[model samples]
Target: MAFFPSLNLVARRLGMYRSGGKGAWLFLPTSSLARSRPGRLRPFHAAFSTSAGAQHSEEENIDHESSLGRAGISAFKRAVLARHSTKAFDAKREIADETLAAILALTLRCPTSFNVQPYTVTIVQSEDMKQKLAACMLGPNSARVLQAPVTAVFAADLDPVQLVPRVQSLERRKRGLPEAYLATLPFSVAFLAGKGHLAHAFKDLFTTAMSPLQPMPSVSTLEAWSYKNTAIAASWYMLSCSVHGLDTCPMEGFDGRRIMHELHIPASRYAIPLVVSTGFAMPLPSSSPERNEEAKKSPRFPPEAVVFKDQYGHAYKGISQL
Candidate 1:
């Protein structure tokens, strides 16, 4: 899936040029990343807020037990740089189940809006199923779909408000929210969900009506929220694939309506966001010796163009200048 909803936004904000086309993203080989380069900007010295009890709660500290360990930082750097869209995959090369599980397990730790993880991933690997899915795609992706070892369809739960009780309870305890407000959370969620009462409830419930109580938590459109959260999780999964020496191609151009119907996905509950094709890439043809070598690097905006200071237009001086 395209991480950002708009390619034009990415181009305008970061000054990046998409490699193959609008949907295509190029991944570099891990060996190509320089060991000394910092992965990203360090805007603040503290990792989190130091205000009293401003600390991240145990539930929020998902990375505390990260298995990425000593090599985690470098591994992530290589993965981010190396992950690119692989237009072709070696159909013969299959990913081990264990490897896929590890990637999925780590990536699932990514945060969702209000911790309500409302995404569903369906993995299609059988040759018969792959062929069926390929038929659903419109462009060159048809060939790419069949060639890949596995295709994962990511969907979002349409009724994410159902998860509110579980999420709010955990978050309330972790974040030190008042226990008195817990009883009324479900009603507030319902009020916000109802279109007729939404505007009044959104304004009154969080403000004047609840003035004696604390502020009501934010509850926006579930469809939009689910899409954003699912995309983030999918991105993390793709990066994890790169870290494990796997390649992935995220495709939003597929016929999602066909997929949902053909696959017997519950249309009422889930909404398909995108499909991802993942596996090892095929070896370069002997006729094109330089293609493999050239794959290591893709066009990217320079650091100075993308990074900013306190303001949007103010470009940050890169470490090279500092």
Candidate 2:
């Protein structure tokens, strides 16, 4: 797949080019970075308040935990830089159950819209499901999905809906924000209810239930939330994979409607927004380049373009009076 280089991102990360609307990258001498101790330069966003988080696209709070230990940083840097999406997987390669578990465990810790925790992880490693998934995604993707060692499909249950009111009431109390107001938060955090509400509540009332309707509606919204929530989780998992010399590909171009049906999930109970295909890479052809030149230049926008002062449109890089 052609990596659509977002000019804005390129300009910000690399500081070399600023075509389109991208910000300019300045030459920060190696001396300057060396003089500045690591971890001391607070990520600009980290220092900004919600007053700022609200204005700019609120990037996630990356509370990094060094699971890699003393040399973990170097290893992590290696993993991230090397990691890339692979639509094609070698059929001979098998994804160990333990490795898959390790990856999913990382995702399970993914932050939810609320503490309500509304997503489910479905690892479709079954040959049956893989075939069905492949069929669903259509020709090439199906072949890839079937050949791939593991396909992790993310779903959302209506379980969070039940707690919405309660969560909302608490949000209002805790932060003086309205109940269910988190929907306005910068990311895809969501809440939904379980199916038990109407069934169980009617019996308790001891009245012949007049309504036989399902309690929840709008499966798309649920799936969308799960996609965002799990995408973040999957991002961390991919990073973990990179460090361990494993490979991962986050793919959504597949046919999700077919996957939901093939997986035997009810229309109401489950919603799959995205599928992440992960496995080992194929052997490089003898003609393959010694260096992945395009990959090497994972261009980014200049620091000035992304970082700003106290307000929007003001570029602030910690001014110091000499």
Query: Considering every candidate listed, which one attains the maximal TM-score?
Result: 1
lDDT to native, each model:
0.66, 0.54
As a whole number from 0 to 100, the lDDT of residue 117 in candidate 2 is 56
Compute the lDDT of residue 53 as modeled in candidate 1.
27
Segments in model 1 whose C-alpha atoms lie over 4 Å from true places: 1-70, 166-221, 286-296, 319-322
Best by the lDDT measure? 1
Looking at model 2, report the run of 10 residues with the lowest lDDT sum.
Answer: 206-215
Root-mean-square deviation of each candidate, in angstroms?
17.0, 19.6
Runs of candidate 2 with Cα error greater than 4 angstroms are: 1-70, 163-225, 290-298, 307-309, 315-322
Q: What lDDT score goes with residue 117 in model 1?
A: 77
- Which tens-of-lDDT digit does each residue in 109-201 have in candidate 1? 987744567788888889888889999997988888899988889998877678778866786777665342343344334433423346544
